[model samples]
Target: MNMASDHAHDRPHEPPSSGRRRFCQACIGGAAAITVGTVVYPIVAFLKLPVRLGESKPVQIPLDRLIPGQAYYADFHGQQVVVVMSESGPRVFNASCTHLGCNVVWDTAHSNFHCPCHGAVFSGEGQVVSGPVSAPLLEIPFEVKEGNLIIS
Candidate 1:
């Protein structure tokens, strides 16, 4: 055989169909699409506005439902609030602890609010009784209309 013919026979020949090349290109494209989606999905989700759980309206509770020296809990403007019936009248306060914004639980046995996070305590009247808290519970404005206790 001639030198050119011998050289051609010695070298490996590429497949005429090019199927393997097409398959590799498709795989690279798919991987790029997946990588871009993984990076962009979280950003798109974060940019979307959060769905609010509750409405921004006034909260109302019947005055008769309040028992003396007992605590009543309610949700107001997406925040947990508490109402305590004192001897003088009804008092409303935010249930969040002043120290670390933890939810304060009503200790019925002690007739006070207790913070489970940091061992803070609050009086039934929303005063800081003891523990790490320096500020009292936040007081919410309310009005008594007819037989309903209206909290705004």
Candidate 2:
């Protein structure tokens, strides 16, 4: 064969596809997926974060207006909380159960709060008395300001 023919034959042949281009495309797709997940994860998590102190705007409630020994519910800082006036003083606690975030109902007959979701029982002071709950009721930071209950 001639010199040109020999040189052309010596050159390595490649498939129609470009390996480097394919690799780069795959890398770009992976990076895009990661970016989208990172951005969307936080947005969804922020929206789902449970109600905690300072997250809900605090409010002042006229606790004295409520009948003593009776439980009343009010929205405190975006959280559904129960306020009770006992001989000790005003008690404020989150109405949500610690076990599964279920709405607890006040058992006036039993003088305690009961979770209908799992039958968890909590004292009027928000202390867990029975059931599968490992933690006590969440207490709202509160103080009696001029006979009004201020929860923060």
CA-only RMSD, every prediction = 7.5, 7.9
Which pairs clash in model 2?
56-77
- Who wins the lDDT comparison? 1
Question: Which has the greatest TM-score?
Answer: 1
Q: Using Cα atoms with residue i matched to residue i, what is each candidate's TM-score against the true structure?
A: 0.67, 0.59
Q: Which ten residues in a row have the lowest lDDT in candidate 2?
A: 49-58
Per-residue lDDT for 114 in model 2? 93
Clashes (candidate 2): 1
* Candidate 1 C-alpha error for residue 113, in Å: 0.9
Question: After best superposition, candidate 1 residue 83: deviation in angstroms?
Answer: 0.6
Report the lDDT tens digits of candidate 1 across residue range 1-152: 69989998996886755898679889999999999999999999999998875588789999999998788989988799999988899999999999999989988888899999999999987888999989999999899999999998
Residues 1-152, model 2: lDDT tens digits: 69988887896765547897678888999999999999999999989957565656666778658776788887765568888877787788889999999978988877899999889999888888999998999987787788787877
lDDT of each structure?
0.91, 0.84
